[model samples]
Target chain A: MTGWISEFMNHPATYLKIGWLQISVSNLLVILLMLATFALAVFLPFPKGHDDTQEPRT
Target chain B: MSEMWTAKLRTKWQKELPIEKLLPDDQPAYVASWIYVFGVLTLSALAMIIASGIVLAFEGPAWYHTSDAGKFTNSMHFWSVQLFFVFMVIHLWGKFWMAAWRGNRFRTWATGAVAFISSIATAFTGYLVQTNFDSQWISFEAKDGFNSMGVGAFFNVTNLGQMLLLHVAFLPLILGVLTVVHVLMVRKRGVVPPIDAEPALSNRGPQ
Candidate 1:
């Protein structure tokens, strides 16, 4: 029984294998993405952030 | 005095926490169309997702996969995710067309977009947690595509344990942290006003 438990815990990879569309969630990319986000926050400024003084466009 | 503590605790522990403890007075100064609802709605769904995710994580993967209560909770989490992404995408488009980046508020807009991207990644990791047929299929298919793209070696999509840890721990952690930062920034600066506000501010700041 213990052996079964060990195998199940260790060999979970044997059961689940995600394909390409799934890997689009690549963990590595997640890091690159985080960095890119920080970059955008600092640089390209897409979503207008908090600026209370600006009045609404007429 | 003793009664006050009990009442406070009860208020805090109720099934539905009074989430809107504070109200926003700083209006957008413009751009208050129906389209803006998508952004706030997405944030609401995100709140639901985080709450449901905590419940499922505490239950453990196998229980959620097999038990009746667990299954229901899992479904709730799953549906919440669907809701999050759907509203997020719509919110993104609405923000985009509004040209929300015009003023000093660009940072907020950019940060929001970044959070959206991170949220999508978090969702992808989430799908791998279920040890069901769908999870199995997604795993194998993802491995091939990712391997071809050259990221499979480092991140084996077929690894259920890894996926579980990532979905419940890593991705959620990042998302939570980012969310905190996003909220803080929004509170500090307030939402950007309408496009016309920009010119108005420019005309007044220096003169």
Candidate 2:
């Protein structure tokens, strides 16, 4: 199990290249995750508790 | 009687950042979005990084390389930094889309941008100071880049002691100060309202 885990973790990084652009799979995954997280943060409904109807505080 | 300089300074500070504004009990209703949470999440990760880093610093590199507990602490520090950057970048993206610089808050945006850049530098120095084969390779590769930019003379990546001092002290100090100023600006200016929201909804002053 430890060997398998180590092998998986230590595998050579996979890269995608197109024209002048090249990126590792791990980095691409992280970028995608950030985008998905941003989308979720935007679309998810905010829980209601605060009285939004109150006068706008200046 | 003329007012004392200390008293005058106090009054100025209070007028600029009143206690209520500095530590408001509640945020504006619009601040309920999940996006707003990333800034605090980044801060939490940074705190973890600092705490773990402090332990590693006290134990030194040899301890971390040899001892199980020190290795664990080092791993914690490394992972915490990863989380910090991830959260910080997301927070930056959120702020960009929301046009957070609106409502005369340009300083807030500028400070955050500078802090991000500083963090990159700090992380680079951290890589150089790892005192391992990876660090050796990175420093060698980076030296030419820095030299081409004409900064290698002043900022020597090959010098482990200089890089370690920069990673542990100078860069962190600048990053910390920038983070503090960024957060303070956020508190002082209040979170920017949505791009199309009512002008009255701007949380610029006392809330």
Candidate 3:
């Protein structure tokens, strides 16, 4: 188990290590892009009529 | 008894989704948003993924990595999956802030969420069954995560045959079923009105 751990820790796939957090470049890119996508989706403005409220229906 | 149940089911579905609404020619004006396109894009990509996956399955993993037809099908599957995730994430994010759960459409929203989760599982299994060094690394890496959550023993990412079966059959089955249910629910309960839009006559579901 220790040998496996040591080998994995040394693997090229383990691209990022900041203190304890470990992730590959591909994984980090996915995370970052998803965050950016969510932010864009939230910040984008709705079309005119869609943004306006009306009185409750009878 | 079966006849009675079938009749009831028929009535319920008809009530929930009348023929015209099920295949409407026009959507509400608010649906003009380009963001709305991602849902259909995601579905289209899913269809492509399944088509390519079927071809790959017919060829088997050895052929998939070696033969020209198999390689093309594999590439199609890969790209389709990439588009599926790209479009699905945008769709999910758009719907989240849109408060798509409004107007008693919680079930519709919930199904979408469940389908997203299932798709992730399907993709993970797909990665594991690739029979490549990437799969080896990922399975080894993912094992610790799953074990920490106490599910590694059951899931067994390193088991090639199990992962292959899961990728080709079980996980895809779950994802497909969940996606179908999610779409049917969306059709049954029309797109939620924008939070600020008037409770228009065109809005089909309960307020």
Candidate 4:
């Protein structure tokens, strides 16, 4: 099990470089994930609760 | 009518943050957005970090390096810290776009900003105390930056004992206090309404 897991995990890291700015592929993926999550949070409909129809408090 | 200090303090506390406000059963309708959930997600990650950190502290560095159980616990701590930062950054982004400081909530935003900085410092100390070649190299490299900034004399990142104490005790205390104050401020001020929501709700300050 450990051997298989280690084999899977041990891989050369890929980095993206744009001039002096460089970031690992892993880091870039995480950043993209964050952006996607933020977009989803904005657009996704929230689950309705008992008070879903309540008037907006002023 | 007593003028005792404790009584006066109690009255002031109640007046400032009554129980209903502190543990509100309901929030404004605009708060139903999924974006608002990231704050609680950040807090959950922080709780996981503290729990895993406590386990790591109990076992020490050598055990974590050599033993399976300790290594698992160490991984838990590492992953928790990662999640904490990820959730916290998302929360920060959400709050920033929302203009969370509106309606006299500048202190809320300020405390949260300070807490984020404190958390970074805490994570830096944690890295320094890792008792590995990575930590050694990082400290050696970081010292120059600290020295250039004129804070190396006090911070001393290379000193394991100082870094360990700072990570486990000092920074956590500061972060905890900031988090409590931030949450209380949120409760007191109420959630900031959406940008396009009612003008009156957006302008409503602390109660």
Candidate 5:
């Protein structure tokens, strides 16, 4: 049992647990993505008619 | 009771608002051109990507990379990601130039923009979960770049399990939800018109 733990730690793939669920560049990109998306959602207003209070001027 | 109040409020707004029920005569004769289709196409591609991704989830990584059915689906997912970005960028550019946000459509534009960014993240996470030699190599290389840039501390990129959760669980959900909301808002608001056009009914030119 002790040997297996050491062996896994030594392997490069151990960091990602790659054989099953692998992690790396793609995930980081996703993180960058989530941050960007979340930021945008918070800032941008919904389309005009979305606010019911506004009366059409024309 | 809240639903009733909400319905009553909506009915009040409908009666009071002087909103345009349909396109005015001043609006463009039609969507500007083929460029307009890029946004919809990108959306289609995103839908395919999610569908393919669900299958990959069911089959597991090894099955996806090794089995023929799995491999084809994986390739389709990969190609769809590339296609989505291509079309989405074009759509973004098209909207920017056309000034597609002139009228009530600002939220639609913003949502689409968010979806573009979110989809890219989803694609990035999917790439990380590929678990191949390329995936392995790219993770380490990408991390070094991030580390140098100061983003490495938050996300290691070298960890497969971490990447998988973010990719399959988090990124997709974010992108999918954002895209859906954007689409709904677009349907609700209708498209914005070309800049400088008069109302569609009164604004007449060459017919």
Candidate 6:
């Protein structure tokens, strides 16, 4: 279990070193992508006046 | 109390969601698309995850990993989370390709996206509390990212107690509230029509 798990964890880890910082490509990419997703979702301008659907009547 | 606030709240809700629209026995013809079902599937998975998680929380991790009943409940929780992510991802992609944000539905779209992010955060805390090598490694690795962002002091991923509290308490609460709001927004706004969808006969002229 230890051998295989360790090997798998070590195998795909593409590490980066910037000064004293150490990180993996996968981790960095995930963080960047999540931030971008949040930014786009929050900051994107709504395309107004395109709504033609009738409002739900009470 | 005069019940004024309660009466006003009920009136507002009724104004936004009348009986037929709130609990409709029917949907538009276009609702036949399979892609639309993913949202409900994700909701079902979330419900299962929450129920299973409650049981596991009562049992604690010791029983969860050791006892047969606990193992079964834990498996249910794990698989439900997997199903939740699977259904949610498909739902997200479907919305993207369909441009489900059209028709002044940006709030509905934004809520879903925010819910997705919240779910990921909850899942990360869930991983941190697993009490295994995987969890330890994950926490160690994630701590660096948090520290880099100056959030590690507040959000210590390596602390099992904190992670467990976050997983079973605060994070789940946030996720649950976000999910409820997301569903309510969807129901209130109604689904956006498909791109290039023709206007209804009522909107145009009698067919």
Q: Estimate each model's TM-score.
A: 0.63, 0.92, 0.79, 0.93, 0.65, 0.74
Between candidates 5 and 6, name the one with more favorable DockQ.
6
Candidate 5, position B14, lDDT: 62
TM-score (C-alpha) between model 3 and the true structure? 0.79
What order do you get sorting by TM-score, best first?
A: 4, 2, 3, 6, 5, 1
Who is ahead in lDDT, 3 or 6?
Answer: 3
TM-score of 4: 0.93
Q: What are the clash counts of all predictions, listed in order? A: 31, 0, 0, 0, 14, 0
Q: Say which candidate scores most in lDDT.
A: 4
lDDT of 2 by residue, B1-207 (tens): 249998898888788889988898887677889999999999999999999999999989999988889889988999999999989999999899888887778899999999999999999998888889999999999999999999988999999999999999999999999999998998888888887775765545333
> What is the per-residue lDDT of model 5 for residues B4-120, given as tens digits with 9 covering 90 to 100?
988889786565332442223332343444554666888898888889988988988788878889989999889888778866776676678767665566777788878778776
The C-alpha local distance difference test score for the whole of candidate 6 amounts to 0.79
Which residue ranges in model 3 land beyond 4 Å of their true spot? A1-58, B1-3, B199-207
How far in Å is the alpha carbon of B18 misplaced in model 1? 23
- List the pairs of residues colliding in candidate 4: none
- Regarding TM-score, does 4 or 5 come out ahead? 4
Ranking by lDDT: 4, 2, 3, 6, 5, 1
lDDT of 4 by residue, B111-192 (tens): 9999999999999999999999989999999999999999999999899999999999999999999999999999888888
TM-score of chain A of 6: 0.55
Q: Alpha carbon lDDT of residue B140, candidate 3?
A: 96
Candidate 6 per-residue lDDT over residues B1-207, each given as its tens digit: 257999888887888877766676666555556667778999999999999998888888899998889888988999899778877887787788777766566777888898899899899899899888989999999999999999988999998999999889998888888888888777776765666674442133111
Give the top-scoring candidate (TM-score): 4
lDDT score, residue A22, model 3?
Answer: 82
Please tell me which model should have the higher TM-score, number 1 or number 3.
3
Please report, as a residue range, the 10-residue window in candidate 2 chain B with the lowest summed lDDT: B198-207
Candidate 4: which stretches are off by over 4 Å?
A1-12, A52-58
- In angstroms, the error of model 1 at B62 is 3.6
DockQ scores of the candidates? 0.05, 0.59, 0.17, 0.59, 0.03, 0.05
* DockQ (model 5, Cα): 0.03
